[model samples]
Target: MESKILVVYYSLEGNTKLIAETISEKLSSDILEIKPKKDIDSHSKMKYLIGGKQSVIKEKPELIPYDINVENYDILFIGTPVWAWTFAPAVRSFLESTNLKNKKIALFSCNGGANGKTFENMKDKLQGNEFLGQIEFKDPLKNDREENVEKARKWAYDICKLNIK
Candidate 1:
């Protein structure tokens, strides 16, 4: 039987979502978008200040209830947009709330500047699981959208080859 897979992510400005969707499509996996109950307005100029502060402080924003059952998936591809040198607060909330032990977890991040400590911080929180792979994409929505998408697709395909065999 094939290992079940899921791509979970939170995108504030469509950067992370572009990569997440690409990976999900390539792997033929279910995708979950993490939506905070109270989300920051992307249109606001203060969004960087607000989102960065939340991420820096490690705040767990309340999430809109998602119907995904994580236990059903054997491999999880968690993606995030970098904020304050870390993953988004909504992704933080999901990691803390979900039961992810022993799962084959892979990570991906999209950032305008750098992934910073996003992978390290996520791995620290996601202890006790086997990491299949991890990848970082820079500005998937702008810099090179098609290239980034193709990278995500190829990365996801390679990860499955390593894990699903």
Candidate 2:
């Protein structure tokens, strides 16, 4: 199969979705949106923070659709919102459902704080895949969507060239 980059993510309040779209547009790659079987109402920040853990514990992530042969992708740009200081439950589900052997996997997180442990939690979920690199944005950048996307694209290029040091 021919190689391509895949930008996969789950967005709760449109920030992450916009980031994903911008990266996809710049990279000209396929985009996949990960949706949960039961949508969590994110209107209340406190509710989203609490409900995310419950959803993870229940193992109830469901995607609206996914058809690309993930294995064929040379580089996988996995994006997610940091929930409970970790990878989003829907992203966890997507990672679990796919086998990422021999593929380069880079992570980009739209999160609320500077806690670096977010990647640690992701490491626990993606135990077997080759972790390429990670780029994270705190809550302050929600208004600077274009700038964030440029950063993500640069990060992707760095990963592809093994320049993430």
Candidate 3:
């Protein structure tokens, strides 16, 4: 079977994007960024905090323009930051917008803490596809791009192998 992988993610502070890019590099996959339809107020830290919590509580997100054909890829390498123990609202929005039936999916999360709980939350949300596995780079690695990249690459390779693709 032929396979095409797409690395899709949302980054509040760019670390998640870096992780996605690293996965793409290791897998030679395409990349897609999920942007919010509504912009958060430039100076409002409270808005981000509130919005992120609302997103997780509601299990939804409002996404901006995404052009990916959900059916085109065989594997999806989904990356996101953990917000309120789940993916960022933008990532949730992206998942809700797309269909993943019969696809192979893996998740990667970068968080400010250990993130085991966050991964569990994400693993549940990704049920539309075969949940190959997940990788989490916790607190120390969040701002360290070089280290996270290597970690993401390894995660990507391991997932690729685990799925026997």
Candidate closest to the true structure, highest TM-score: 1
Ranked by lDDT, top first: 1, 3, 2
State which candidate has the highest lDDT: 1
Pick by lDDT: 1 or 2, better one = 1
Worst 10 residues of 1 by lDDT: 140-149
- Candidate ranking under TM-score, highest first, comes to 1, 3, 2
Backbone clash pairs for candidate 3 read none
Provide the global lDDT of candidate 1 against the true structure.
0.92
Model 3 TM-score on a 0 to 1 scale:
0.84
- Cα RMSDs, all models: 0.8, 3.2, 2.5
**Candidate 2 regions with alpha-carbon error over 4 angstroms:** 55-58, 140-143, 161-165
Residue 124 displacement (Å), model 2: 3.0
Candidate 3 segments exceeding 4 Å error: 41-43, 114-116, 139-144, 162-165
State the lDDT of candidate 2 residue by residue for 1-165, as single tens digits: 545788888888776787778777767789888888677777876766566665457454676666778887777788878776677778777877887777667778887774456678777767767888888876524556667777877866666656222
User: Comparing candidate 2 with candidate 3, which one achieves the higher lDDT?
Assistant: 3
lDDT of 3 by residue, 1-165 (tens): 758888888876667777887888888888988877775563686966776666557646567776778679988888877776667777767766766788888888888774646667666666766888888776424466677677777878988876644
Error (Å) of candidate 1 at residue 4 is 0.3
